[model samples]
Target: MKKFDILALGELNVDLLLNRIAGFPEVGKEIFAQDMTLTLGSSTAIFAANAATLGARVSFVGMIGKDSFGEVVRSTLEQRHVDTSNLIEVDNAATGLTAILNYDNDRANVTYPGAMSLMGVKDIRPEIIREAKHVHVSSIFLQETLHKEIFEIVRMVKDCGATLSMDVQFDPEEKWEFDYRKILPLVDVFMPNEQELMAITRKATVEEAVDVILPYANVTVVKMGTRGSLVISGGKRFHMPAMLNKSVVDAIGAGDSFDAGFISAYVRGKDLAECQRLGNLAGAVNTTAAGGTGAFSSIEAVKEAAQRYFGQTIEL
Candidate 1:
């Protein structure tokens, strides 16, 4: 038997969130913030943690440093019941981190790639790939080495006889230079938000972007925030409306949560619509708590949020 159902091959980082700031940052001015929090962060970390919470046998393969921040990342994923056996620690680089300045609903972020950027396809071994039935990779743009060797990374998973999923989280540089025609055909699931879909495809509208990818894409899932998600498979479209939380706390990791929900179900052989429903609920639940993982402490917690808020039970 495989050691895990899902292997999260992605970036790891810590988040330093500053809330209730006195004023916006200026050229060289000092600012004070009333609230501060330090927690595990990164789209991949959120997906791995929440997937484990939803009862998936999940493992993480990412790079960290020999610093205290790295310890926090390791300990946090372990606390979430995510296997960290494949996490690589390097002596030269510090762990990645993002400083988030929060306003009411939106936030400004400054990221330090650090050690995460150093991990490339060479860091992943065939043995590790064989240990999982599915491999998930995210935040392609943030890691320079991974970005440069993405085609090889996806191909490696396929050659190892494992399915692959990718969430190309926003490209900060706005270059959107990924070779989708060559890459999408190899990916089992292509998960991207609406804006990301347009940006990556170099199209002005979602419809046009989807058209661009249709020929080469397999199963494409588009995250349309607030409106829920749209799934395309075998040229058929499935739309799931958002089950909005009555009282939303924050939306820090909702999309990642969506990925967690969908993949958790997908690996268990759930249908497209069922996967989309759970994904929507997971995303809405994520917003009911602080950060990306607050609402997903346990499977019971996730199910409770689904029932209490959306009046739906998450069987998976």
Candidate 2:
């Protein structure tokens, strides 16, 4: 048996979220925010934490700087029980940070890559990959400089007999342009949101997008917020409706939680339908709080939500 159940690789950051007023600022004009809060982000970190909370032995592999933000990132991971021994601390670079602007249930973000850009394939140890049941990669853009090295790392993990999962994060800055078709075959599971699937495949419909990408992986999950998610594999598709909730406070990290939920259910050899339900429950519950990792529900809490909202069983 593998020593770890899952290993997440990619960027880590501190998010400074500002809630802007309802109206947009005019060109060359300034607008003030009503309130704000600082939170932990970085997609990989959030997912790894959620996975650990859901009962997976997980490790985080990424780079941070020797700064206060880096300390917060490490502290947050430690609090969530995620293994951070593999997290590299860069002496010269500053930790990654982001400023998020939120308004009327919508949000925009401005990010500074910082030390996250410095992570390379050499940072990954072969022995670590050999000890994991599953490996996940996130935030492809921030580590564009190390794409070739990342590909090599992914190949090595697969060669070592671990299942590979990938989460795609689109960067408007186009710091890196990913060829999904080229990378998909190397991954056992390809997870992306509806918009991301469309953008990557250049397809007009979700079904079309799935058809184009399905050949690349054994399983593909496209997360559609509110409406739920679509899971497809071997020419079969399952649509899981979103779990209805009363109120939503913050939507950050919901997708990462979904990834954790799905992988948790999946590693246990549950049916695809049940996995989607668990994933949906995890995502819906995450919106009820602030911050990414902070919002994730416990395994029992998620099971209760699934039973209460969807009248479904979350198979262990």
Candidate 3:
């Protein structure tokens, strides 16, 4: 049997969130915030943690520095039950971090791409890829080396006979220089938010973008905030409504949580529809907590939150 059900291969970082700020800062001035929080960050880490909570045997394969932030990343993943044996630690660079300034419904972020940008194809091991039945890759743009070598990484997974899912998180550069036609065929599932999909495909609408990628994409899921998620596979399409959360603490890692739910169900042979439902439910649960992983401490916690907030029962 495979050692892990899912292997998360992507960026790892810490988030320093400053909330309730007085106002936007001017060029030479400093502003103070009323609240602050330091926590593990990165969409891939969120996915791996939540999937492990959902009862998937998850392992993480990412690069971090031999620093305090790296310890935070490793310990947090361990606390969440994700295997960290594959973590690459290097002394040359410091761990990456993001400073987020939150204001009401929106937020601004500045990131330091440290060691995460240094990991590339040379770091990935075929034996590690072969140990997982499925592999998940996210936040391509944030990692410079991984962004340039994504095709090689995906091909490696496929060559290991492992199914792969990719979440092309927002490209900070906005260049969106992805070769979708060549890459999508290797990706079993393509997960991207609506805006990301539109931006990547250079299409004005989600429909147009979907059309552009449908031919090459095997299974594509478009996450539309509040509205719902759109799924397209084998020439069929369906829209799954969001499990609306009226009192949202934050939407920090909702998309990653959705990915965790969907992929967790997927590796267990759940149908597409069920996977979508779990994704929506997991996303809703994410909003009920403070950060991306606050609500997902355990499977029972997720189940309780799902039932209490959405009145839905989650099997996983």
Among all candidates shown, the one with the greatest lDDT: 3
Worst 10 residues of 2 by lDDT: 171-180
TM-score of each: 0.97, 0.89, 0.97
* Best-first order by TM-score: 1, 3, 2
lDDT of each: 0.93, 0.81, 0.94
Q: Per-residue lDDT for 1-316 in model 2, tens only? A: 8888888988988989788565775789888888988767788888898888888888888889999999999988988889988888999789999988877767777888889887777777888888888888887766755565656767887888988888877766643456766677888888889878877787888888888887776789999988999888787888888886667777778899888888877776778877787788888867766666655546676566556655766556
lDDT of 1 by residue, 231-261 (tens): 9999888888899776788788999999999
Task: Look at candidate 1 and give me any clashing residue pairs.
Answer: none
Local error of candidate 3 at 28, Å? Answer: 4.3
Worst 10 residues of 3 by lDDT: 307-316
Global Cα lDDT for candidate 2:
0.81
Q: What is the lDDT for 122 in model 3? A: 88
Which regions of candidate 3 are displaced past 4 Å?
A: 27-31
